[model samples]
Target chain A: MGNFLLVTIQVDLYDRLALNLEADLVQMVNKTGAKGVLIDISAVSIVDSFMGRIIGNIASMSKILDAETVVVGMQPAVAITLIELGLPLKGVQTALNVERGMDLLKTMIDESPIEDEQEYPEDDPFAQ
Target chain B: MILSLSKDNIEVVREQDVVLLRNRVKEVAVKIKMGLLNQTKLITAASELVRNMLRYGNGGTCLIEVVSRGRDNGVRLTFSDQGPGIADIGQAMRDGFSTGKSLGLGLPGSKRLVNEFDIKSKVGEGTTVMILKWANG
Candidate 1:
């Protein structure tokens, strides 16, 4: 809530809803300038390849916007299904639950290197 | 060696039908006492295939059946679409090969989630896919 945005998916999302969430979540990240985003899907019972791609897309988009994403509370069955679906959710970080996910997001945000602009000045020979 | 205990048909005509199909599959899975993991797998596979029917097939019909072989029980689903049939089913079954804006895991991925899978299609005709999941598998 401080520098992070938290979203909990409590329903079995349909295709259209999942797509809308992907769009809205990315927009929210841009609008709020949140450092980290947590998506809690514990209540979600299934993660088809489509949903899997949406999660991956969200994480990648958030990364491009300078925000880290952590997907949390995935059911064990859903995890197994995703792997079998050949969607390993690459590039997306996961946590056991929301609390751990928040901690992971904090660590990710804290450990990330500062912007290069602040570390290098125009007058510096290496600033190119 | 499989006997059909009960059968029903679901018409997949719109986006909402996909959701209805999944719920019906879930109901059948639970009726047969399918394990949670297996139920989830069955429902997910149903979701993928039904969406394929709606997207590529321009909607279709799904047949739900409860089947049994010896002491084993399972749910069998048949999705038939009148849309343009696949030109190359072999290519379609390969992972990451989609003609649509998707991850391309619908065919092959659904195959992995169930116990048995079969597909039939003819270019310009239509496509039909059948899948079965053993309750205990």
Candidate 2:
């Protein structure tokens, strides 16, 4: 079993470049065996469709890593834009702030039983 | 009164023209109090249309007009380009449909952002795309 890891991304309000962030988040989730990730976009005043897609992609990939993804600090306007654009964020959790997200993650970790004995057979094609 | 702004045949078909078009759209959007989010949507849709005209049509003119339909008040933008017109307007409207390496979100995605959309094209003549978005009263 992999050890728990935590990663945080602080999004800027006007930063337009997002492909790099998306790739990095996916890579980190795959490499760190993280239990969860917190994406803080409190500073972002706008969430364009391109940026929305990247965040959605990150959430989808993190699910494959068995890591939960939490979005923090989404401005009200950004949430409306996401809804208007029809970006699917069904499985992702959201919080009003990073502190709240951390508290929620901690609770989820404590209440959930650790799966230390889950093992894959050798030569399994899907084994990482 | 509705005002008209057009680019010279050569000047109209450029990526920078998108910026000019967006500015005009913003001006009209503000006059009607469309809110920031609605303005952004109009800008995004306009940018995509302008880019398509510049890249595919080699150059084209855009028209911006204000309109009021019953209780709805909004801006209408029409982009007309005289280049090798699209042979398949239906296919072009599909997501992931592109002649190049773009994400292919131009037509369909822009359509989603606007309240109303219309497109007319001729294979050899040219194409015109119209989009409308109303202010949220």
Candidate 3:
């Protein structure tokens, strides 16, 4: 939690950039040995399926490396777009903003073995 | 309508073209004062469809315009490609369906993002997808 990484994406990312980000993020997770990764995407308004999958992959990769990932500051539109894209963003934890994400990360780190997965209804958009 | 704008067209052949197309959609959405959520959804849908045009089809043309009917105003985007075309449109629209080994969320997922979606294709001719997002939705 104290060593979490904060990444902000400010531009519209093409496919290649998205792939590069995925690779770089995983590497950073391993190198820093951070307990959590917080990505601030408040500036990004649009999200395609490709971007959605890349985010999901990044979370999975980080989790395997013994790190928690909290994506913060997601615009309502982007979340809504991803939901409609049929990507549940599984295994990814989200927070309203950077502060809340940091708090969640700290709590997870303090609690150890963050195992609870808040379930959603069958029709819920974020349900995975 | 104060949002009347001329037709804007772009050619989608390479990966860069996809980004450009999405930007154009965003511009039109902004002109119509479409909400941030609507703009995001429209741009995302445009990105997916443009990539589909480049991936499955032999590159295509995207037409962007601000459309108004009576009192309703919205942004409309139509993508047309003269690629090999889809032999089975129904099968292609199913979720998690892909022939190129991708995630297969291009078509059906994009359709769900916009307010209006229409697709037409011929086996050997081409395919065209049209989408619209209303301002007040």
Candidate 4:
């Protein structure tokens, strides 16, 4: 079993910065053969479509590294906004809290493919 | 008009200032719908417009107004920049269309998020973007 990587981001939930975060997380997962990754966003009160896209992108990239990505502690308000915007979280798994995400990831690592079925679409409008 | 912030004809100068403006817009949007996920789209669009004013216009003021339009309450933000205007307004609106590396989704994405979008630009003059969105009521 590979080691787990936990990265916590405590920044304002904006677009450009979120893109930077996604890139960083993707790079970390690739660099370290971590079995799973847990993202903590309890500090963020708001999230937008651009940020959602970034999270979705990270989740998609994690699968390539054979690592599972899970988002933990998303605020209710932020979740609601994401639903309204139609921003699909795509390959990422989510837990009510970090502990739960860790448990879920552990289970997946032992059983089915830890990598999620959802893949990033090639024709994404926001593709850089 | 549920929320409106009018500056006494002053220009906003600074990158952080743009974030603040975006926060205010988000605040209003959140109030409209306690569970609105469009905050990301709204904030992204607002950031793009504000960035345009600060980068191209050098530093121009903006008036942000949120109104309840149609079935949903939407944000109506106007950014007026007094900088060198665009030569081709149509070309500027296209995606992957950026004056710099910062993802040119400013004009197009902002237009997409809102229900109504209007832009007026003139060469050697200035540019004004008016964006409107109706809440999902």
**lDDT leader:** 1
Worst 10 residues of 4 chain A by lDDT: A113-122
lDDT of 4 by residue, A7-121 (tens): 6778675445777787877787777768788888877755554466677778778877888788999878566555544454666789999889889888877766433333444
Q: What ordering of candidates by lDDT runs from best to worst? A: 1, 3, 2, 4
- Tens digits of per-residue lDDT for model 2, A1-128: 23434444453312134677777777877777788788887766545545565677777888777777778888776576555555545677888998888877766666556443233345567776
Query: DockQ, per-model, please?
Result: 0.76, 0.15, 0.66, 0.16
Ranking the candidates on DockQ from highest down gives 1, 3, 4, 2
DockQ of prediction 2: 0.15
What would the TM-scores of all predictions be? 0.94, 0.61, 0.87, 0.62
Check candidate 2 and list the clashing pairs: B13-B59
Q: lDDT tens digits, residues B1-137, model 2?
A: 43333322224744445555666677778988898888877776776677788778887887777777676688788888888999989999997788975657778878888898999999889999998888873
Q: What is the lDDT of every predicted structure here?
A: 0.92, 0.71, 0.85, 0.70
Candidate 4 — which pairs collide?
Answer: A48-B40, A49-B40, A81-B36, A81-B37, A82-B37, B72-B135, B73-B135, B74-B133
Candidate 1 ranges beyond 4 A from true positions? A114-128
DockQ-superior candidate, 1 or 4: 1
* Top candidate by DockQ: 1
Model 4 gets an lDDT of 0.70
Question: Which stretch of 10 consecutive residues in model 3 chain B shows the poorest summed lDDT?
Answer: B1-10
Q: Which of the two, 1 or 2, has more DockQ?
A: 1
Q: How much of the true A–B contact set does each candidate keep?
A: 0.82, 0.11, 0.93, 0.16
TM-score of chain B alone in model 1: 0.98
Report residue A20 deviation for candidate 2 (angstroms): 1.6
lDDT tens digits, residues A43-100, model 1? 8998888888889999999999999999999999999998887888889999998899
